[model samples]
Every structure is written in structure tokens, then in C-alpha cells.
Target: MRNPKKRGAAGNSNRAHGSSAPGVASENTDGGYNAGMAVFSYIIGGIIVWSLIGWGLDFLWGTRWIVLAGALLGAVGGFYLSHMHGLTSSRKNTGDRPAAGGPSQDGGTNAK
Candidate 1:
């Protein structure tokens, strides 16, 4: 047999303290913000690398358009590669596979 008065008291206390439950943890406590920043870093790294290359080429050839092209290419390619590899691989490693019958980010289908 359960004590109804004890249960009610517990619930009332939880309500008073703005708590959802006795021992349940919240969902926003993970490292998602860090992961997002890391991805951004990768994109920025690609742009810097390409920019340096373009700068060197310009220095050698005395042109002004190569650096812009390099920056553009770096941004696009970096984002694509990061989306395809970084995010998907992390999800796959964490056992959260993609949707069914769809191409996943890890170069494989999420078939059951």
C-alpha cells in the first residue's frame, strides 16, 4: 500500500521549488554548444588555409582575383565536408542512425 498524503506532499514541494520531478535531469546539459563551435572552427580553418594559399599565389603572380576565389571555394567545400563527415559521424557513433531508407552522412544507408 502507498501513502497518499506523502505523495501529495512530495508533489507539492516539487511544485513549490519549480522542479519537474524528484530525480529527473534536464536535457540542455550536454556539450552541444561545444560541438557547434568546433564545427565552426573547422569551417574557419578551411577558409584560413585557402586564403593563405591564395595570398601566396597572388604574391608570386601579382594578381587580385585568386584570393577571393580561394575564400569562396574554401567556405563551400569546408561546410560540405564538415556536414557530411563531422556531424554524421558523431551521430552514428552515438548510435543515433539516420532515417530509414535514406542516405546517411557516413556514406551508408540507414537500413534496418
Candidate 2:
């Protein structure tokens, strides 16, 4: 009969804690403050840059609506980009899979 594979110290600790390895920190470990800051920066930065461009265009074309449109577009784009990147990073750190989006066994998307 073949001997059963043995679980090492780290392996046993991980299994015991429902697959979360000891000393592992989640993506949102610090009350999501970092992510919040990142998203905020994205939105604010986008607004500032696009609004400046719009202001310059308005100065040249004498149109008042361009700034509004640019700001709105920038906000939407920033929110979208931030949300996408956040999801991707969270999935990566939490071992989410590509198929069903659940946790993966290898701490990331399944290789096969």
C-alpha cells in the first residue's frame, strides 16, 4: 500500500483555518482605506485633467458646454477604470478563478 501524503506545518495551518494561510493579509486588510484612496485619486485626477482640457477648448471656441461634458466623461471613465482595476486586484489577491470567479486552490487563477 502506498503511504498517504503528509501535510506540512504550513499546509496544516492553512487547512485548519479554512484555507487562509497564516500571515496572509487580504486585499482590503486596512479597512479598505487604500483602495478607497486609489479610487478617489483616479476620479479626482481624471476630473482635473479633462476639465483643464475642456477649459482650454472653451477658451478657444467660446463654448460653455464643453467643460461640463468633459468633466462628466472624465468622471465616468475614471469610475469605470477604477472599478475594473479594483476587481482585478482583489481577485488576484484573493485567489479568484477565471471561470466561476470563486476562490482557486493555488491562490490564483487555475493554471489548467
Candidate 3:
């Protein structure tokens, strides 16, 4: 004789696939976190490396302002590197090309 007091399914409902804890996201990142982390690491790493180089130069050349210059240069170079890697939003949303030739950023189409 089967029990009639059960209200729902017998298995655990809170458990998720590929994970044991609850409230975990199942969507695939597709390397989204990798790109973001790369951007962050590039900026911070550039600054640290340039500052060290500048410190060495200052020690050799006997100047106190080279470190500041190196930090500034690092910031600029980091931004440039990020742009070169195409990690910025300028190249995003490339898969949604409208079939009707939608308007561009300038509020107009490129078609003649």
C-alpha cells in the first residue's frame, strides 16, 4: 500500500546540478569572467611593474620625480592595452545585426 499523505515529489528540490549548495547560478559564463579579470590584472599589474622600473631608474639617475611619471604612463598604457585586446564595450553586441539595416550610433544608416 502506497502512502497517500505525501504532497509533492520525493527528491530534494533545493539541490542544483554540478553543485551541492543552493542558490547557485547555472548559466554558462563563456569566458566572461576571464576577460574582466584580464582587464583588471592588466591595469594593476602595469602600474606595479612601471612603478618598480621607475624606482630603479630613480635610484640610478638620482631623481625623485620619475616614479610619478611611471605611474601616469602605466595608466595610459593599461587603457591602450585593454582597447587593443577588444575587451571594451566598443565592439560588443556584434551578433545582433538587424536584417533591415538598423540605424547606427549616429542615428542614421550607412546605406546610401
Candidate 4:
């Protein structure tokens, strides 16, 4: 007759033989920041920059249009900048997976 503990150990070894070591899994090395957030940050930064420029011009020139113009330009620029930033960073981080357009894995784009 064989010992039960010996049999259990043998069984355990067999289970682990053909498998990957525990906790060894494919991991993304990009710190997990997705494309949307990247774009959002870029847009926000652009807006701030443009807004400041506009505000400075308004202050110096005594014109509110300048500031308004700056805000408008900033909004447009922000959208584009953010979108591009998001796409580029996403691509770099996610490898070959598509980062924009045609239905994302996480649903649709949040662009406004």
C-alpha cells in the first residue's frame, strides 16, 4: 500500500508540470493610462495655454474679443491636440491594437 501524502505530492507535481509558473502573466508595461485620458490632458493643457495668451492680449490691448478669440481657438486647438495626443500615446502603450475610430473595446469615444 502507498502513503496518501506521497500520492498527494505526486498529484500536485503533475498538475504544475505542464503549466506556466504561478503569477506569470502577460502584462502591459505602459502604466495603464488609456488614450482618452492622454487626449483629455493634452486638450486641457492646450486650452490653458491658449486661454492665458488670449487673456494676456486682452489685458494689454483693452479688448475682450481677443480673450474670446483666444478661448475659441484654445477650444478648437484643445480638441485636436487632445485627440492626437490620445491616439499617439494609446498606440505606443497598447501595441498594435487600434486606439481610435470604429468602435473601441471599451465602447465609444468620449470626445465632445
List TM-score per model, in order: 0.49, 0.52, 0.55, 0.45
lDDT of 4: 0.64
Best by lDDT: 3
lDDT per model, in order?
A: 0.69, 0.70, 0.72, 0.64
Better of 1 and 4 by TM-score: 1
- Give the runs in model 2 whose Cα sits over 4 Å from its true position: 1-31, 87-112
lDDT of 1 by residue, 1-112 (tens): 6677676654475542533654433454444665576568778988988988998999899999899888888887778877875542444333566557845677566655
Q: Backbone clashes per model, in order?
A: 0, 0, 0, 0
**lDDT tens readout by residue for model 3, 17-80:** 5654553335443446656776787888888889999999999999999998898888778877
Steric clash pairs (candidate 4): none
Kindly list the per-residue Cα lDDT of model 4 for residues 1-112, writing each as its tens digit: 7777675755565344444554322243343444456566666777788889989988998888876777678778877876654454433434766556766575556655
Model 2 local distance difference test score: 0.70
All-Cα superposition RMSD per candidate: 14.0, 16.4, 10.5, 17.1
Best by TM-score: 3
**If ranked by lDDT, best first, what sequence of candidates would result?**
3, 2, 1, 4
